[model samples]
Target: MSARRFLPGLVVLCLGAVLARGIELVLGANHLLVAIGLGFVLANAVGVPDRLEPGIATHKLWLGAGIVLMGASLTLDTLLEAGVVVVAVIALVTGSTIVVVELLSRNVFGLADRLGSLLAAGSGICGVSAIVAVGGAIRARESQVAYAAATVLLFDAVTIVVFPIVGDVLELSGTVFGIWAGVSMFSTGPVVAVGFAHSDVAGQWATVTKLARNALIGVVVLGYAGYYARSADGSRPTVRTLWDEFPKFVLGFLALVLVATAGVLSPDQLAAIENAYNWLFVLAFVGLGTEIRLTELRKAGPLPVLVVLIALLVASTLSLATLSVLL
Candidate 1:
């Protein structure tokens, strides 16, 4: 792609990122949420120019690359220290959440499989990142991707604030509550912010547990790709197709974990890479927001939100059950 052709979309994303940064600095809010919201406002208010569409289409690529860089922040030693309980809780929560959402999307929402799958990933696994990853794995349509993201962001924003308050009210210990937040919250940023808000111990535990959860995303996406290919096309994907469709960035992410565990990179170097990850993610969110049309989301109806609302309850119950053992 020529720089000239890509410049328009790049400019649009840069504007969105600037606005997001300003909002985050002023309000102490999640920048991705702000960026996406800004994108939504521009998309619904005036519409994006055709020149920017090609660049915006690269958001999934940005998202994938960000996930890879995110791995550098996680060390295998920390993962091991988190122990089997945390890993088990994450696995149970991730699997159960996806299953529940997928079922609800079909029976309750009457939604299509493609859109429903993205919602499952977004609400169940991580959020927009996981949604975009699974969306790419399945080759989901742009409208479905937007609907899934809009649906999750709506609920995730509320949890960012509410979870901390609830933890305080319950007077849960930092370790317990950190596990709760790590297992329950839909996104990484909110969980870390809320966990630390509760306590330093909670924050530490939350980061480790959440990173463990995030690492499982690749395996889950691979499973989804297999299931989707079989159910949608009536032919099982061959090894070649799986190799082609599987997210290579996830492998890169795992490699970074090894690098992080190796103890070669200085703290400053790792921090710099993390900052780069944030910028990449911001760009991705800006691209995502630019595509969201309020009109399209409205057409998707209230069921997506309903699905997320139900997920909150399911997540809470599962989180508490796991914490009971861990605590």
Candidate 2:
């Protein structure tokens, strides 16, 4: 709990974030992805010393803070502007993706129950954050958490490039492409990048849609918590248990949304919050990249990958078709 324990890793993350920004400036690449790549290279090629591991582990804290701050960039008005139809589509796609991944992972891939749940939450909600939240809720093994996170991270990297290319090929409008990426992509960073890659309008839509999905993380995690608790004890989870497992950062996010919707923050203040969240995400993702050991990912084998692939393909194609018709 001491600051010293986290200082070393925080320093590394900060430096990595700064370097990612520089790379973004010079090469015109997405800073978040660059941050992840830099962390991966350092962890895999250069190697992280044992002394830094404790601090690096705090990346989740930074990620949670980033997400909460990001809420300032959105408002109820923004969501309302996206239309009730868009909200309905986001809910439907998110729910369906979770169900499909769970079914495929269990019935077809034959993965462990906890691992399947981890993948389901990751694919259905906010990627690594959701995986971590649900993993803890279900008391998943560390290996299962690692495997699920790696699978989601891999897809996030892949989709960042592929979605934009697909949008261009299909000649989809910005709104359609943004909603598609937002609904289908594994993580927020990649979805945002892919959306902006199409157009600013697309980026806004993508962020809003993705946030809608993200808002469901607490409910999903709570459900998993109760299910796993009941499975373990043959008794329902207590109110205290569910409350303890709830993601408090989600409350922070929702509060910020209310504040923003109330017009409490000036445009300058909103911009500042946006900048803070962006930098926090860069630092957090750099830490995320460092955690992804190629050997660890390889241990996940092919089953989980196949499960996600099938789910993504089905969910994305259906979402695209629906958006094309609706939007």
Candidate 3:
């Protein structure tokens, strides 16, 4: 590609990242949610001029890169600190949520089994990225993926904003509060920021807990991949199916986390890793925002929105209740 042609995309990437991070810092909250909501508003109420769509749409690649940086923040020590019981608790909460949502999607909502299962897993697993990966693997329709992503983004915003408030109201200890937030929130980025915004100790606990939760993504994906591949054939799976079905970025993401946690990397090196990760997050959110049709979301009617709200309520209730009894 010519330099002139590439420059516009490169510029968009930089600007979107800077804008997202700046907004996050200025808002001192879940600014990504705000940006997404604003994007929805602009696209629906006002308008995204046709000329600017391409630049905004290029954020998907950046989001991928951000995910990689997020892995760098993970360390073996952090995982170990979360403990067996905490791990078990997270497993149960996330696992059960997935199962319940899956059943609801199919039985109650009367959606197709595969798409319903994917949404349940995504919502109950690691949020948008998880949903996106599973959707690709199963060759899910655009509508399914959009609904799943919307579910995650909506709850993510709610959990990130509301969890801290509940923690304070309950007068929960820093450790218990952090663990609650960590286990409940689907995505690591917003949870970490929110936990830290509340307390340093809470931040530390939440980061460790969130990463531990994320580590399960690899396990879940691998399990699904293995099952699907084997069921397809006793031999090897086809390249087309495998490539389309599997999310290759996940392995790279885990590797980045492991390498950073291995104690070989210096502080300066870690800083570089974080920079790359943040940009990827920005890009991913941008892609999500770009693809979202606000009018369509509205037209999908209140049922989907109601489902999201119910899930959020269940998650929050479970989180704080768990903290009360267990902590």
Candidate 4:
């Protein structure tokens, strides 16, 4: 309302963009700017205090902007190019990964059900956004959400760097590599970056597969909402659960897909929209890092890492298998 009140968020916006643009220059013309953001999130999670949570403070605006910018990159053409079987494969692998991660997190690692579910969604869905949206809807603690984000960032970094090399060594086609990367990688931006580095076809199909993967976030969140409601009320849920916890911006994301499909914006515009979101991704990560305590990650014990590794193995195996079959 007041200028003083608005100052903090404005500062976050400026800092996020400046750091993101700087990283863009350093990375030498690449899309891994999101990685910088993700790294920032991990750093903050380990050492930064709770008071400096930028992503939380600016919640509604940046979250929506990030969702919208991501949406701008989606299109029916990209989906068609990726093909129905490939799309189905992406969905199935992601779903399986979530279920497997949930099982391991709860039964094996002894994590609370809510925390495990948040981690599972973060691992299996679109990364921080999905974590935040699902965490908020399910009323999970900020600490659990932060930990899930950190885990996703750590593994996503590994996959983004490692997958391309694997693709090359295996001598896979771009389409196959893209499908593999898109399905296995935790974040869409990195998948796009890795895919493009391999081939144009890889990039296109990776984007398509990632979008298809993203489409699951809203559905999963809504399902969680229903599950939670049922747990709370001792009855089946309907319209009310949807109203309370459904991620509304995901709808806006779908609308952007329609607009892109219709060719309303030029390529440059689409690129700019994606770049803007990439910057937000960076800021969200930096904000995330600013809040972390390095010692806390250590204290989370080896089990979290083990759980993540198992999920990674499952996802990677499924992704490569899908590639071998589909492409």
Candidate 5:
């Protein structure tokens, strides 16, 4: 309720967004990436002053809200258009990444199972969101969750820049690059950014593929919750448990998707919604960047980072192979 804590943080975020826009106009940079880079520099170089901490904390809300609104872009026909093959590729990539990351964390890296699972979920599924969800399900330490989030952020920045270049160098077709981007990316925004930055066809395919991946977050989280419940307390999971654990924001996305499908909103209205989601997403990403404390990541040691890197490489390699077969 105090303005001192919230207002300062809000102002800094606005400044970051404005700066990102300026970079986009001048350099044709990806504004989301710029916002993240700007926030990282501000945080690491001079530190985000303590007064603005509260508003920065609100970024999670922004991330959720923005993602929900992003549902406006999805419709039933588009969803169906993604087809069975694309869905199969996504599932394969996700399952493979998680299994490989967990195995490496346990056998190769010699980390605890809880920490290993958190890292695996983050890298394999939806980055920070999946890490936080699975971490809670498995009762992972807060420190472990932070480390997993940081590790994903590191790759998020790297892949954001590198994916486009790799696609171009390989002269990848739009469909191939789209599948690759959707399966390999841990988050939707970066997938959209990289795909669109390359070509329109790639962007369209990426959005559908990524959304399909995102929709499975609830299923994946419920599975983890059930797995841990039976192991820890010997309680079998039930329908109620799955309902309680489901991500509500996904429902919001689905509602908006129905609205889109029903043709309830005019084109202009949908455009405005799209614009709103972009702003919210950029703001959330800026907050995410500021929250990353490099010191904590360093404390996480080499194993977790190595596991994430390897998992990413595996995901990338596997998705590429899948694209070869499908495309």
Candidate 6:
């Protein structure tokens, strides 16, 4: 709780963020990915000092804060403007992806329940953020979280390029391509990048659709929490217990959305908040990257990747087909 206790890790995270920004500027790579890559190299190749461990462990705090602040960017007006058809498609695709991933992970692949849930959340929702949120809600192991995250990142890398190519090959419209990518992609960054690679209008549509999916994170997380709680005890979770298991940051996220909807934040203020959350996410991902060990990740084998691939193919194909008809 003391500032001194966290100072060492915070210093490392800040330095990592600066280095990530430098890498981004020089190489034009995604800063979030760069941050994680830096942390992974430092931790695996160089090694984190024992003294810095405690502070670095506070990455979860940073993650929670980032999620809460990210709420300011998700005004209700944007969702409404995306239109009812887009909203319905987003919900349907998101929900179906989660269910398919969960079933494949648990029934077919024989993954542990929590690990499967983590993968489900990652595939079905906003990628790493959803994985982390659901991991916390379900009390999943760090190894599992890392494994799920790595899989999502892998897909993010692949799909960013592939989606653009597919869009061109299919001669899809910008609106259809954007909505398809928004519904099917693993992460927001890749979704936006893929969308814009097609056209400006596609980029805007992708961002809105992805935002709608992102808004469902809290709901999916809570649902998992309740299910896990009940399965652990063989009884329905009481309100008190469910409340205790709830991620409180979600409440803050919702509150910020309301405030932003009411026009309480000026554009400049909202931009500032966005910048803050982006930095927080970078710092948190650095810490997450450090926690990932090659040995531990290897224990997960290739099943997670296979599960994700199947889900992605199904989700992307189905969403694209559906969008062609709807849009």
- Give the winner by lDDT: 2
Lowest summed lDDT across 10 adjacent residues in model 3 is found at: 230-239
Better of 1 and 4 by lDDT: 1
lDDT of 3: 0.63
Best by TM-score: 5
For model 6, residues 73-170, the per-residue Cα lDDT tens digits are 76777656647878888888888888888899889989988888888899898888888877877778888898888888777756756787898899
Q: What tens digits encode model 1's per-residue C-alpha lDDT throughout 115-167?
A: 98998888777777788878877778888898888777666657765787788
| TM-score of every candidate relative to the true structure | 0.68, 0.80, 0.66, 0.66, 0.83, 0.67
Cα-lDDT of candidate 4: 0.68
Against the hidden true structure, what lDDT does model 6 obtain?
Answer: 0.78
Instruction: Supply the TM-score for candidate 5.
Output: 0.83
**Better structure of 3 and 6 per lDDT:** 6
Compared with the true structure, all predictions reach lDDT values of: 0.75, 0.81, 0.63, 0.68, 0.78, 0.78
Cα lDDT, model 5, residue 297: 49
Cα error, candidate 6, residue 210 (Å)? 6.8
To one decimal, what is the Cα RMSD in angstroms of model 4 from the true structure? 5.2
Clashes per model (N, Cα, C within 3 A): 0, 0, 9, 21, 0, 0
Q: Can you write out model 3's per-residue Cα lDDT over 1-327, one digit (the tens) per residue?
A: 444544554465456556766877877645455445555555667676655656666555555455555667667676566477577778777777766676676677776655665556666667777777666655567887777677666666566567777777878787887787787787655665566556756765775666567666655655555545544432332456445534455566678769977878898988887666545555555445544564444434355455545555676577667767766
Comparing 1 and 4 by TM-score, which wins? 1
Show pairs that collide, candidate 2. none
Q: Write the per-residue lDDT of candidate 2 for residues 28-78, one digit (tens) a residue.
A: 987777887888898999999998998888887887787788778778876
